[model samples]
Target chain A: MRTTHVGSYPKIPDLPAPGRWRTAAEKLQRGEITREEFRRVEDEVTREAIADQVGAGLDMVTDGQIRWEDPQTYFARRMDGFSIDGLQRWFDTNVYYRQPVAQGRVAWREPVTVEDYRFARSHSPRPVRPVVTGPYTLARLSQNRYYPRFSDFVLDVAQALNRELRALDAESPPLIQVDEPAILQHKEDLALFREAAAALLEGVRAPVALYTYFGDARGVVRVFYELPVEVVGLDFVAGVRNWEVLESEGFPQDRRLGFGVVDARNTRLETVDEVLRALDRVSRFVPLDRVDLGPTAGLEFLPRRAAKAKLVRIAEVKRAALEVTR
Target chain B: MNGLPLFPTTTVGSFPKPPYLLEARRKRLRGQIEPEQLRQLEEQATREWIQRQEELGLDVFVDGEMYRGDMVAYFADEMEGFAIAGLVRSYGNRYYPKPVVVGPVGRRRPITVEWFRFAQSLTGKPVKGMLTGPYTIAEWSFNEYYPTRRELVLELARAIHEEAVDLERAGARFIQIDEPAIHTRPDEDFDLAREAMEIVTDGLSAYTITHVCYGDVPRIYPRMLDLPVHQIDLALKNEDFALLEVFRQHRFTKDIGLGVIDAHSHRVETAEEVLDGIRRSLEVFEPRQVYVSPDCGLKTRTIDETVGKLAAMVEGARRAREELGAG
Candidate 1:
């Protein structure tokens, strides 16, 4: 079994004096630090974030998205014709994001996430996966004043994000992950989401993983199987109803299953024995070779220390699961 | 409810933070400025919002929550046995420090009363004392110390009761307890949240109001009626006046804070649109029971949009009053 994480690792604590990238970004806004200084800090923290996952014994890794203010708005800020405005609540969570406001025609001006992925690759011996905020999620979370229809906005975002995906694919990472947390909430728009998602994954050379969390995806799990992706990740921790889908053989047998057993939102630690048991239940339906064990969502909700500890246990559990299957 | 006008116009809570005030907050965070400097800035923002509400001819006004950072975190910072956690995602990319209950939750001092006094001192018009309800605080936070969610919420309820009573003693005639979290998990936790809310508002002498925003109200009704509040405020306009049917079906006995303005949108509601919403709500609620307001807090909107929306709301309420033949 392979070990991986959903995406975000908790921010590396600034020991001695405590702060994160948010504090640094504030300083940059106030002109207290030069652009060069800010980039240096971002690069330094990104390295620490990567090390957090790599040191925890993971086969595939991410840059921990340290520089991102939030998943959606960070990309929105970097893209053209999209402005970050107003802190809208992210789903029902206490965290907020600057709502991505579509001001004009959406287009990709330059690479948004490629450089960060390259930075992570340069530092780590393990393969670093590039995680992009999926087009459907970006469209759903945004305030679309310019688009005539919501689908028009989703398509434009798909076209824009496709360029970023192709750029990252040029580097030939083992996998490219597109996060679609909004898909679980919009089951009625499954047909629309599939079209938008297909547009996003088109012409990508690397294997694509479409990840969903924050709610159950059992209602629309069948829709994801038909999409042109190699991996489908479901949050078993939050999406408890997904187990029935698994039992009913709803998951596609041809693709890799990122089976999430660890609860990322809560701080409690899951023991290796417990995680192995969950994997055993998953192994009944899916082949062990096609299964990747990981957390239900990003680990940002927990403290850095707690998140790291969770990953360490997950890695140990993955090893134990592999031994059992072998 | 006494001496209130027919279809009284007010805000749920909060107004937009201008660019300067946002900068001041950042400065205060970096220790570049003193707390006194930040207080001066907050005072200036509060005065501007109060003056704007007065100019717009609003019946009940709020201080716009100029001194608060996040709704739940602000109270947690003031209370004992609660510590602010690292930034957790509430939605999209907007983050707030989730409060962690480390010990018994209790109020050490008054949080919003002084700010209430300052804003009430400025205007002859009554300013509603706004607070984040205990259920919302307990729901949004991560409790490590408490044994059960119900216990923690009730503990938070006791702390919040202290703040509500303090606001009353500070001469606040109208107090709005914001419980935006009640909209989530209605099937399992609705009764628990309602019970906690009753604990917060029980025995309060002020004219009590509860604002539940960005939610489906019809699902939580009957249970919502048991909140022990004098008024139940909801974002009716955002629902496109669908809540009128609920009000009509259930027959609201208490006052209704009808939200006629959409706070999440950049498009300012025309006075006609606001008037239509108020008229539709009046079909279900009595004119004396109607309190016209926005769907939620105005903090997410631009300052210009906030002012324009409030002006339109007041104008619409005036039109509704004229049409109904009630002054």
Candidate 2:
């Protein structure tokens, strides 16, 4: 059995003088602090984030995407041809993401996630998986003013992201995660997603995992299974009906499956037994070794304390499941 | 119905914050500035916004919500039995303290009354007293206090009712209860939404208006007309005038706030585009029953874009008034 976080740990508290990433960003904006100084704090926070995950005894670790303000806008601001405009409420959540407006041809100017991933890889004792917001999601979330057709936009973003993924792939990380939560929203575009995902994962040396959540991906799971990736992550908590899809499709024994047992969207703490029970249900589809346990989505919605506790619960649930197997 | 001007122009509350105001807000948040100092800055910002709207020839105006922060959090913080949670990202770079309903929700004192007084003092034109609607407050908040969602929503409704009545008592003629969250999840129980709106606007002497943005207005229609407000402000420009067909298809008796300018975009709307939107809306609604406004709050926009959009909206409304021969 393996343990890991999907992405985004809660904002690390800057106690004594409390502050969050927004606070730091505000300071940077006001010229009260410099970009170099802001980055120094981010590095400090990122190190603590990795340590928190390590302390929880995760096998496949992620950088927690602590620096990403939110998934879509973070990348939107970095990429060419994407201008982030007003804030749009992120789905039904209280959270929001700056609505990305594609005014021109989407192009990758530089490696957006490589340095952050390298920093995380250097700090972690365990194998680190760098996560990127999937191209399909970027296309879905953005208001495309340039593209005549939506598929053209998705694939264009895919090509742009392909450049970044290839750069990260050069380092040969153990795994790379492409988050496509928007796939559930755009099931009609599955055929297009296949092309986009293939292009995104092409020429990449590392194992690629495509993850989806926020809705049931059961209808789209078969399409995801067909994609060029080593692992498929599903939201078992939110997509409770996903179990039926797994039973019908039957898990590919050779491939990996990420079981999202923890509910990251809500603040409620899932009991260890509850997680163990979900894992038991997951076992029916795939063997324990093939399974990766984590949150249904990023833990950004949770407070720092609750997010940490959930990590501890995941560790505890994994140990309990492992002991039972032994 | 009340003989309001043909193609009346108003804002959907908030205007763009000038850089100095944003800086002042950041300083206030950091505890570098005192509460009085922050209030002075807010007052200054509010005055500037009111003056701008008057200059733009808007028939009605807003204080631009300068004294407020997040719409829900601002009210939640002031109310009893509500606790403010940590800053959660509401959108890219923008954050709001999620309100957690931990106990019985009620108003101990006036929330927006004093702010309305200050804003009304600034402008002879009627300023809308803005409040977050009960359904949105209940929806946006983490509810732990009430037994059911209905109960929680009703409790919030009662609290808002208090604020609305107080605003009326404070000599404000227009009060807008914003319910931006209602249309987001259209599948959810809307009876609770209607019940809550009825409670909030019950017996209000003020011209009751409700603004719902970034949602599918057509999905909630006809039933949405059942909302107890005198006016319904829909983000028509963002919906790309799609809801105009819905309005035409259905019998919409009440006044409609036609959002001719897209508030979400930073682009300055051309007066022609705004005029086109107004003309389309005029086809569906009587000119006297249509209020030309921005699709949503302009807080997210830059000052120049906001000013330009409002100017276009007013100019478009003026053109519509001339075409309708209502002058």
Best by TM-score: 2
- Candidate of highest lDDT: 1
Residues B1-327 of candidate 1 have per-residue lDDT tens digits of: 457678888898889887889999989988999999999999999999999988999988899998998898999999998886566645433456777788999988898989999999999998898989888998787776886778888888888888898999999889889998886777768888888888888888889999987655787886788888999998877658887887778888878888888788889999999998877776787778888899889999999998899888888888888887775
The residue-level lDDT of candidate 2 at A79 comes to: 90
How many pairs collide in each candidate, listed in order? 15, 4
Model 1, A135-209: lDDT tens digits are: 989999988889899999999999999999999999998899999989888888888998898889889889999
lDDT of 2: 0.83
Q: Per-residue CA lDDT of candidate 2, range A119-192, in tens? A: 99898898888999999988898899999999899998999999989999898988889999888876888898
lDDT of each: 0.84, 0.83
Error of 2 at A121 (Å): 0.2
TM-score between predicted and true chain B, model 1? 0.97
- CAPRI classification of candidate 1: incorrect
